[model samples]
Target: MSSKRERRWWTEEEDQILKAGVESQSKQIGEVNSLMSWNEIAAMLPRRTNKDCRKRWYKVRSDFIKGTWSREEDRKLQQAVQQHGLKWALVSRDVESRNADQCAKRWQHGLRPDLKHTPWQPEEDAKLLQAMDKHGNKWKKIATLDLPNRSSHDIRNRQVLKQLF
Candidate 1:
């Protein structure tokens, strides 16, 4: 099998080219549709593939929109947590988009206030057992209903069958 070549980062010149092309195309099309396809944009640039162009486009858009997280934002996030036990999602919405896993990690890492400890209640155990009985191993869906706060990894670890044959 032939090995794929490594991708290079976009330089300032390429950024200029992409911006100019997008601007001109948008004006011509009377909208941004013509400029939205990264593959078409890549075809106009030198030595870049559709994937590379798309990745760079997303990065540029994110940096331009968010302007990177600042020290002041970090300070505010910390203060919000200390003063009112604010959720990371609420505090960091302006600084960064917090997905489910990121929010969990932020809480675990002490970036947010510690979540109240909630042990698996008896009813939760019964529901999990019943779901497992019906589904035979659809831990993800079962976890969603029975342990909404738990991660898939956590649910997997807690599975009795996971420890058995």
Candidate 2:
């Protein structure tokens, strides 16, 4: 027997069912998300299999799951990653929502700020060299010297460029 069901888009009504299923299934704080069984939640949404119900439930729950991305969400994700590095758990916490996976995926694409690509002006290069001399190649500290639109990474890359050339 074949094992594939034709994929179709979910309706708003189905979304409502998924929300209700999540509500009925889960109760209280930090109970490990057993809420309702997959089978039970699937039964609540017509034509949705257990896997579908489970995946959809994630979309419905904002925590440890996600529904949609927003600009504000992208900003939060960027800020969190900046503050916490690739520590996804800590980043997600700072973002105030989303599972670690969602946070990771969003960060990999959205709000991954574009690196400076234009040729550095001579003045900027001089300032960078001066900053390096003052700060002793400490890129993070040099960046704090107010190189507009330049991150510590940019400061580091500028030094690398000098070595290469």
RMSD in angstroms, all models?
10.2, 13.1
Question: lDDT by residue for model 2 over 38-157, one digit each (tens)?
Answer: 798788777889878766665656555346887787788888888998887678677766755678767653345653456778888889888877788887677666564566776788
Looking at model 1, the pairs that clash are none
Instruction: For each candidate, give its TM-score against the true structure.
Output: 0.35, 0.37
- For every model shown, the clashing-pair count is 0, 2
Error of 1 at 145 (Å): 21
Provide the global lDDT of candidate 2 against the true structure: 0.71
TM-score of 2: 0.37
- Local error of candidate 2 at residue 110 (angstroms): 10
Per-residue CA lDDT of model 1 for 98-164, tens digit only, reads: 3222333444433433222456667766766777787767766765665565654455666764458
Candidate 1 ranges beyond 4 A from true positions: 1-5, 33-35, 62-165
What is candidate 2's CA lDDT for residue 113? 66
- CA lDDT, candidate 2, residue 60: 55
Model 2 Cα displacement at 27 (Å)? 12
Per-residue lDDT value at 136 in model 2 = 84
